[model samples]
Target: MGQGGSREFEGGPEGFPPGSERRSARQAEEAPQENAVVPTVLQWSQGGQSVYVTGSFNAWGERIPLRRSGNDCVVCLNLLPGTYQYKFIVDNEWRFAADQPTVRDEMGNINNCITVEDQTSFMREEQPSGFFDNNQNLYTQALPDEITLAKEPPQAPSHLWCLPLNFPPLCEPHVASWTLLPPLGVTLTHLLAAAADRSTNTLSVTQRVRSKFVTMVFIKPARGSAADARLGPAPAGGQAAGGGFALPQLPSTAAAVAAQQQL
Candidate 1:
């Protein structure tokens, strides 16, 4: 009922070389007799300095790096028939291609999605039709049963939990505190999942939690100017006065938020 659930998805027709793949949304309904892997290529065309993709295939653990192709970054993978939700990390920022199919998790976090169908039915559909584009893909929409997986795993359990706005994460202060603000000139409102930078030793907390704003906070550095403390509750013995926010709740005023910048 756990990772075993993922196996049923991997059972499909054998995949061909990348150039031999077929693409269509209608072919999914006809489960022709086939058994092998499916070749999947994920592309990020938003233009970023660096891009990598990660999702359900690897339990959302390791990010598969994408190679640059003109204005796009692309990666090809051998996946079995299944539904997967993924987003690209563009220049260390979490983002999804809005033009593609998307699904939101329980927390309203959105990610680009792809569905790989069996190869047999897919190959059979191209009966002497005009040649398909060299870059055509086989992504299809989810069937009834597969829709349930949209929420199966987006983030790990630690960051999956939701806390109401202004609710304290720990009774005492955490690391240093940095206010969260939307990127300048950004208007479309959407949720950004929690992420931590190990090299910078910074933790970002973002939660909507009945609030309209997708607010976030950068846990300040407990050390000197460099924030060296990890994001979490205080140490075992006692609380550190400078570890968390001085205020009982986050700043809520328009004046307070308008002048802020993300850490």
Candidate 2:
């Protein structure tokens, strides 16, 4: 009995007592090992023969090459929750991220920027089955007939009616006043009526006759033509009154023939 008691008091192999080994094992089991949390991944979608990412995260010293998947070259970076400025090197040439936000560095060079946030609460709140939970009941209730009806077509513009109608002339006179004017007044009235007509052929003929008459009056002013007298003196620069229509120095007979043919 004494030998068994002494054996119990003595230590076990490796100087560890029998009960101590069991106690240490229990303590180790109670204090569980903690697993490392996976880092957040950042990805880029540009594809090239060779692509790499270098940024402030790596002190701009390391070049992480992107892996090509189908048409896109992507790189996975384990980033902490913070902002980062970076750029892509494609085919040995530097490039900024196409769609990411950018900021100018001290050297005036643009760099792509990104922000990371802790996703623990986001992961917990996300619903896999009902992705749009807020909008699910929105379409369940029927809408009113009036609300569902298609909107009325927009109204036409006010000036649409003016098309195909000749614009009014810049000058006008009462009937008695026109009669007091020279016989040229009657000719102008006829010309104005022809201009206001919607017929294209008639308008073309009137324009040609009017141009020829004005050219003739300016080039070889008739001794006492009523229109020429009423027009007063020609401006110093040879520009005619009533819109400064310049009289051609040399009128060609060919142009007159062409104008007549266009009538």
Question: What lDDT does each candidate get?
Answer: 0.54, 0.51
TM-score to true structure, per model = 0.34, 0.32
Report how far off residue 95 is in candidate 1 (Å).
Answer: 0.7
Can you write out model 2's per-residue Cα lDDT over 39-85, one digit (the tens) per residue? 74545676557677776666554577777767777767766555666
**Clashing residue pairs in candidate 1, if any?**
12-36, 13-35, 13-36, 14-35, 14-36, 174-243, 175-243, 176-220, 177-220, 221-227
Report the C-alpha displacement of residue 60, candidate 1, in angstroms.
0.3
Which is the leading candidate under TM-score?
1
Alpha-carbon RMSD, each predicted model = 30.1, 23.4
